[model samples]
Target: MSDTPPILVVDDQEKLLRLVVMLMNRIGFPEVEGVTSGPEALERLRERRYALVISDLEMEPMDGIALLREIRADDDLMNTPFILTEASFDFEDINVAHQAGADAFILKPFDMAVLKTKLKQVLNSKPRKREAPVAAESSLSNDFPMLGKF
Candidate 1:
């Protein structure tokens, strides 16, 4: 993991956060960091550079969409790759995340293989900017082949 970039994961649920961190480690990302809130995520982002950020969609004070927007607004962090994860499929929420510059979206209860795919896709792609909303279902299916299973 010395040559690999670190990953940051944000989820308010402690158990979920730890689970994700563990899965990321198991999937070849040994330098995974977990934070409990968006504010803490922002603090970490400002403090260090990360290869990617995977955040839960429903956190308080600052949800994933809000955090993405904040990251996009900042010139220094505007190009950071981000993946937003939600427990349930909500079209409106997904659309908002797209508009906020999320690199990818994953529905929760995902296995390690699904997470590995998303991490690879996001990390290999160029940085993205906030864009107009698109058809959420089509966008999700195109990006995540296993999305229909959830």
Candidate 2:
């Protein structure tokens, strides 16, 4: 295999997923993989190591914050860089993502330039190791009613 680590992109929308994967490839990420759901993303992560994970903020069953919490709780995958993307300017969502240990958050409709810059910054930076495991049942959803109880 090549020396470049692979990247995982998760999005419920197939078209968006394909577009993001294509963008990553065009940006020089040769090993970009896309998954349709949070569970599928987790399965992919367990199957192999990835340089980073770019996931959408809104998804059924498990949202980006929920997925992030799960990753943080797992010792093997906890330190992997994670970026959350959303289609809106919801400040509340951003705050929860930060609290959930996301490495970066990008609003949707971002240009290629913005995506490239954010990806480079996240991919190069070391993710902060959590001092304690994330709660199995995070009350973050309760705090953010709009996000629903994940």
Candidate 3:
């Protein structure tokens, strides 16, 4: 990835997805990309490197947590910064995401200022270069939300 790689924003809501993409581009990520589903987001990730991923917590087929888990399980993609958002999350849900290694969390409607700050933080997080061999693979599953209260 280059110094400032592109960004990916995932949300099933088209309007909010566009809004996030527009605002991110306005705030410095001119290559911001948006996808409406978790599967599409995964496909995009396989296609190119992304500086950050900002995803909504709720989605069909695969939610943000499932997307995050899949990303984490991939050795090539594990270090990418992830920022998950929601309207409001139950306390337990927050903890579950935290344990799963979310880089940042934001509650919507997004405050432009806070969003910018988080974007900067995650985009700037340099991945550690590892000389060691490939790490053990962890299985990917979409059962995260069940561990948390709705």
All candidates: CA RMSD (Å): 3.3, 6.6, 7.2
Per-prediction TM-score: 0.85, 0.84, 0.80
Using TM-score as the measure, what is the rank order of every candidate, best first? 1, 2, 3
Tell me the tens digit of each residue's lDDT in model 2 across 5-44: 8999999999999999998889898989999899999999
The candidate maximizing TM-score is 1
lDDT of 3 by residue, 48-145 (tens): 98888899999998999999989887878888899999999886666677666677778899898888877677667767344553222221122232
Query: Which stretches of candidate 1 lie above 4 Å from their native place?
Result: 129-150
Winner on TM-score (2 vs 3): 2
Instruction: Give the range of the ten consecutive residues with the poorest summed lDDT in model 1.
Output: 141-150
Of 2 and 3, which scores higher on lDDT? 2
Model 1, residue 60: C-alpha shift (Å) = 0.8
Report lDDT per candidate: 0.84, 0.83, 0.80
- Residue 26 error, candidate 1, Å: 0.4
Please count the clashing residue pairs in each candidate, in the order shown.
0, 0, 0
Deviation from truth (RMSD, Å), model 2: 6.6
